[model samples]
Target chain A: MKELYSLSAHELQKMIAVGEVDPATLLDAIFDRIGSLDKKVRAFALADKTKANDRLKRASEKKLGRLYGIPILVKDNICVKDEATTCASKILAGFRPTYDATVIRKLEDEGAVLIGKANMDEFAFGSSCETSCYGPTRNPWDLERIPGGSSGGSVAAVAADETIAALGSDTGGSIRQPASLCGVVGLKPTYGRVSRYGLIAFASSLDQIGPITKDVRDAALILNVIAGYDEMDSTSVDVPVPDYTKSLTNDVKGLRIGVPKEYFIKGLDKDIENSVKKAIDVFKKLGAKVSEVSLPHTEYAVSTYYIIAPAEASSNLARFDGVGYGFRAKESADLIDMYLKTRSEGFGDEAKRRILLGTYCLSSGYYDAYYLKALKVRTKIKEDFDKAFKDCDCIVTPTSPTAAFKIGERMDDPLSMYLSDVYTIPANMAGIPAISVPCGFTANGLPIGLQILAKAFDEGAIFRAAYAFEQNTDFHLRKPKL
Target chain B: MESIDSKTVRHVALLSRLSLSDKELEAQSRQLTSILSYISKLNEINTDAVSPTSHPLTSLKNVFRKDDLKPSLSTDDALKNAPAREGDFFRVPQVIEGK
Candidate 1:
C-alpha cells in the first residue's frame, strides 16, 4: 500500500472509499509525518492532533460526500469556526470565529477532515513568509530558503506532505507565487467565482480563494468542491460551474497560447526564463498555436497594485480596532486612546506600514491623485488582458521571476520583496483565473514554475494546458529531498 | 511624488487609529517614501480617458437578498471571540466622555 501521507487527495479518497485505508489511520499517518517534518517546515499555525481527531470523529458521521475522509488544511486568513484564524498577526491573537468561512463549510459538507490552519503573512501582506507573527515558513526544497507567501504555509504544507491539499487566498499572487516556489499546483480562480463570505478581507476586489494541491487533477477536483455562487458574498457571480474534472483531458491540440514577450524582460532569472520558454515549446509541439503576445501595461502592474491594494486594504482593515474581537489594549484614558494603543501594540511593522500608506492615499488631498489615479490605471491593466485574451485562449508566463530566495534576503528592502511577485500579480489585477504548475528546476536544485492564465470563467483552458504539460513532464512527480 | 516624513507618518497613523513609536515612525517614513517613489512610476501612463474598476469582474452589484428573519448567531456565539464580554454585550473601551 502507498504511504497514506504521500498520496494525493483524490488517490487517498479512493482508498478510503474502498476501506483499504481507514480514515483515522490516514489521519494518524499524516499527523505523524507532520510531527516529524513540521518542526523544520513550519507550515502549520495550529496543528493540534487532538483537535484534528475530534474533527475527524465529527466528519465520519456525515453523509457520504465527495472527498470523504481526505485531510485538507485551510490558510490562517480564512475563518474556521472554533479555530484561531489569525492571518498570522498579533492583532488577531486569541480570537476564534463562531462560524466557518464559506470554503470551510463546503469542505465539511464534502466530509473532508479539517486538519489545521496554515500560517501566512501578517494579514497576507508580504511576499516571503517572514512577516508572519509566528515567524517564517521555510521551503521544503531547501530549509534555508523561504517558502513564498502570503500563502506560504499552505503551499509548503502540500509540498512537504504535511497535508494532502490546502485552501489559500490570493491577492496579488499570494497563492500562485508560493506554489511556484514550493513546486506544487496553485490556482487562483476568477474573482467572484468562489464565495468570500468569511475570508478576512485584505484587498477585497483582488482577493480570491482557491485550492493548492499536489497535481493538476487534484486542483480541478478540489475546485469542483469549492467553486460556486453564494448569496452571502455579493461579489460571487451566479455563473454555471461545469465539472472541472471533465476539462482535464490531457490534450492541448488546437489551443491558442500566448507567450507574453513583456514578461521575458530584465530582472527575470535566466533559469526560470529558459524553463518557461521550454514550456511554451511543449505547448507548441502539442499542436497548440503559440504567438508572441503583448500586454503593454505589464510593467505598470506592480505600481498600480501597490496603490489600489493598499487603498482597499486600509478600508477593509479598519474593522480590527479592538472593538468586536481579537486583542485589546491594556488600559486607556479614553476610547480613542484605547483604539490607538491596541492597534499599535497588536499589528506588526508591515501591517502598520500599509495602514499608514493607505491612510495617506485615502487622505483628503491625495485621494484624487493617488487612489483615483490608481483605479484608472487598473482599468488599463484589465484592458490589456481583455485585448490579449481576444487573440488567444490562454496566456503563459513564468510564475515568480525567480525561485524561492534565501530567508532575510528581501526582508530589509520592502520594495525588493514586493518585486518578487511581479510576474504573478497581473492576473489578480485583471480579475482573471491563473494557475502555477512545476515545469523545471534550477542548477542549484530550486524548482521553477510555469504560469498559465485564462479569461475569467475559462479555468477550463488553464487546466487543459497545465494537465497536458504535466503529463509530458516529471516535474510535478518529483518531491523535494526533505 | 510627495515624500513621507515623520510628521505625515504620525498623522496617518493617527488616522488609522494606530499609534507608532518614534522608531516605527522613522522606519515607516523611510520605507513609505521609497514605496511611493516606486508607485510614482505609474505617473508615466496616461489614464485621462480610463474609468476605474472598483468592483469585481461581474456585472452584479447591490445584490439584495429577500428580507426575512433567517437563522442568526445566538448572542453567546456572537460574543465567543470577544476579548471580554459583559452578559450579551462585548466589553469595549469607554466611548462616553463623562466620567
Candidate 2:
C-alpha cells in the first residue's frame, strides 16, 4: 500500500471511507512525516500536535463528509479560532483569532482536519518566503532554493508531503507563484468567489484564499467546499457556486486556448519558455484549439500591482495599531510613540517597505499621480483580458518567469523580486480565476508551472482544461526526492 | 517627476506611523526611488479616456444580514489577544497630555 502521506486528499478520503485506513492512523503518518522532515523545510509556523490529535479523534467517530479525515494545512493568514494566526509576521506573533475564517468553517463542516498553520512572507508581502519571521521555506526540489512566497510554506508542505493539501491566500500571486516553484497545483478563485470574512487582510481588493494541492482534482474538490456566498463578507458575490467537481472531465476537445504574446517576453528563462510551449503542444494534441492572443497592457501589470496592492495593504494593515490587539510596544511614552514603536518593532523589512510605499502613493499630493493612475491602468489591463477572452475560452502562460531562485538571490533587489510575479499578477488584476500546475522541470531538477487563466467566474472552464492536460501528462505524478 | 530622498522616506515613514533608524531610511530611500522610477512607466501609457476601477467587480450589490441579534464573541474572547488589558478593556498609553 502507498504511504498515507504520499496520497492525495481525495485518495485518502476514499481509503478512509472504505474502512481501509483510520483517521487517527492517517493523521499519525502525516505528523510523523512532518516530525522527520520539517526541521529542514521549515514549512510550518506552528503545528499543535495535541489539538490536531483531538480533532482527529473526534472526526473519526462521526459520519464522514466529502473530505472526511483528510488532513489540510492552512496558511497562517487564515484564522483558525484559538490557534495562532501570525501571518509569518512578528506583529501577530502570539495572537490567536477569536473566530475561524469562513473558509476554515466550511472546510471543517465538510470534515477536513486542520493539521497546522503554514509559514509565509510576513504579512504576505514578498515574492520569496525569506521575509517570514519564522524563516524561509526551502524548496523540496532544491533545498537551497526558495519555495516562492506569500504562500511559500503552504506549497512547500504539500510538495514535501507534510500535509495532504493546504489552503493559501493569494495577493499578487502569493498562492500561484509558490505553487509553481514548489511543483504543486494551486488555484486562485475569482475574487469574491470565496468568502474572506476572517482572512487577515493583505490587500482587500487583491487578496483571495485558494487551495495548493498535489493535483487538479483535489483543487476542485477543496474549492467545492470553500466557494459560496457569505452574508458576513459583503464583497462575496451572491451568484450560486456550481459543484466544481462536476467540471473535472477528461475531454477538452475543441476547447479554445489562448496563448498570450505578452507572457513570453525576454526575461523568461529559455527552459521555462520551452517547457510552457511544449505544454501548449500537449493541449493541441488533446484536441484543444490554440491561437495567439494579445494583452497589450500586460507590461504595466507588475507596476500597477505594486501601487494598488500596497495602497490597500497600507489601509488594511492600519488596524494592527497598538490600541486594539496584537503586539504593543512596552516602554512607549505616549500614544504616538506607542504606535510608531509597535509597528516599527513588530513589522519586518518587506512589510515596512510596502507600508512606506503605500503611504507615499496615497499621500496628499501624490494620490492622483500614483494610486489613481494605477487604478486607471488597471482598467486598461482588465479591458485587454476582456477583449482577449472574446476569442478564446482560456489563456495559457508560464506561471513564473523562471524556476525557483536560490534563497536571498533577489532579496536585496525588490524590483527583481516583484518581477517574479510578473506573469501571475494580471489574473489578480482582472479578478479572473487562474491555476498553476506542474508542466516540467529545469536541468537542475526544479519544477516549472504552466498557468491557465479563464474569464471571471469561469473556474469550470479552467478545471476542464487543466484536468485534461494533467491526465495526458505525467508531470503531476513526479515527486521530489525529499 | 519628484525625486525620492532620505528626507522624503522619513516623511513617508512618519505618515505611515513607522519609526525607522537612520540606516534603514537611507537604504529604503534608495530602494523606493528605484521602485518608484520603474513604476513611473505607467505615466507613458495613454489613459486619458480610461476611468479608474477601484474594484474589478462593479456590479456588486450591498449585502445586508438579518437585523435580529446573533451570537458574538464574549468580552474575554474579544480581548484575549490584547497585549495589555485592564478590567475587560484594552489598555494603552495616554493620549491627552494636558491635565
| TM-score of each model, paired residue for residue | 0.98, 0.99
Candidate 2 A-chain TM-score: 0.99
Tens-digit lDDT string for candidate 2 (A275-375): 99999999999899999999999999999999999999999899989776788878989889999999999998889999999999999999999999999
The number of clashing residue pairs in model 2 is 0
lDDT of 1 by residue, A332-376 (tens): 878899888998989898888888888899999999889898888
Worst 10 residues of 1 chain A by lDDT: A55-64
Question: Interface root-mean-square deviation for each candidate?
Answer: 1.2, 1.0
Runs of candidate 1 exceeding 4 Å displacement: none
Off by over 4 Å in 2: none
The ten-residue window of minimal lDDT in model 2 chain A covers A56-65
For model 1 the local lDDT of residue A228 reads 97
Best by DockQ: 2
True contacts kept of each: 0.84, 0.84
The candidate that achieves the highest lDDT relative to the unseen native structure:
2
